[model samples]
Target: MLLPSRPAPVLALALLLPPLAAAAQTPMTATEFEAYATGKTLTYAQGGTIFGTEQYLPNRRVRWAFTAQECQEGHWYEADSQICFVYESESDPQCWAFWQEGGRLKARFAGDPDGTELTEVEQSKTPLACAGPDVGV
Candidate 1:
């Protein structure tokens, strides 16, 4: 006796399953992730991963060193939290940077004038900073 064959629809779905799953697993948008990052300070957990510091100015301007790991991986607010900026680590001298404007998140690297678009990650409580001055005001 011959065994029954799989349905054509099932076979088609099996072929498309992997790509569909991958699309669903795409990384969270900058906006989505930024919500979790704002109003907080980020620093390197280890000394050598990247080294940098953030200086909080009295005028609400945060001066940062992009070369430093903390600055490169860190996120901060500008203009009294009117805008949020993030420095994502990268292999080249250029790194991923993003900011929020008009209820949207825009991203760019280095000095690129044309920026990429981003989606916001779900909001999450800011992570605690262990190395810097207490931000607990």
Candidate 2:
């Protein structure tokens, strides 16, 4: 009996793809995102580093604080299949595409195919903190 020949590189590549394929998450809508995030403080990470954290409140309200930046309060809404956020400090909206991976969520900055990506790494009862008179507000 003759055995079929297979390229070693191709076989190795095929074997390595299962985990990668499983990591791809289905994109989420605004409704789904809000339902999942409400009343929770979610910490996001990028490239194994803590990126920032956001506290989700009722009625689409959000408070976001970067690792080394001031905390900004914002609200999110759905527009054209993207979840766009507008902060009180910055009127311009920052949009993102959210994906649900198992019990966590991931996001990619909008309009940049190769830009920054974020994955949820933690959820805490304590909210984000900021300095100034508007810190806890």
Candidate 3:
């Protein structure tokens, strides 16, 4: 005799869940990015190693630094479905596509030869430390 099965319901429930890979693939819009990053400092890691950290300030302004390195002041803007950043040290824009998954941010550099990708390892409300000219009293 044919009987009800749990596998069918489980399969249906699984199908109802959003695809995490696809969600991660879709880049966050500028508004979404700003809402997530503004007033927060985020640390990123690459290949399981600490890469750098950035503090997002008001009006899209930012301060970025490599591990134990001096910070660079920059600003970010949206350009053709990508977020582009310009730093005082480098005029050339560095573009990236950013997304959030599992409440963490991920970034992929545009036109990177090594296919570099960064994952946010930590986030905080504290500001970044920049010890140099134009920083602190």
- Give the candidate number with the greatest lDDT: 3
Candidate 2 global lDDT: 0.71
Cα lDDT of model 1 overall? 0.33
Models, CA RMSD each: 17.1, 12.6, 14.3
What TM-score should be assigned to candidate 3?
Answer: 0.78
lDDT tens readout by residue for model 3, 73-128: 89999998888988888768888889887889988677564345678999999999
Predicted candidate 2, C-alpha RMSD: 12.6
Q: Candidate 2 residues 1-137, lDDT tens each?
A: 00012211233333544555534656688889888989899988766677778888899999988776777888889987778888887757888878887678878666543444677999986777765666657
Best by TM-score: 3
Give the range where candidate 2 is weakest over 10 consecutive residues by summed lDDT. Answer: 1-10
Error in Å for residue 37 of model 3: 0.3
Candidate order, TM-score descending: 3, 2, 1
Choose 1 or 3, whichever is better by TM-score.
Answer: 3
RMSD of 1: 17.1
Cα deviation at 108, candidate 2, in Å, is 0.9
Which runs in model 3 stand beyond 4 Å of their true positions? 1-24, 133-137
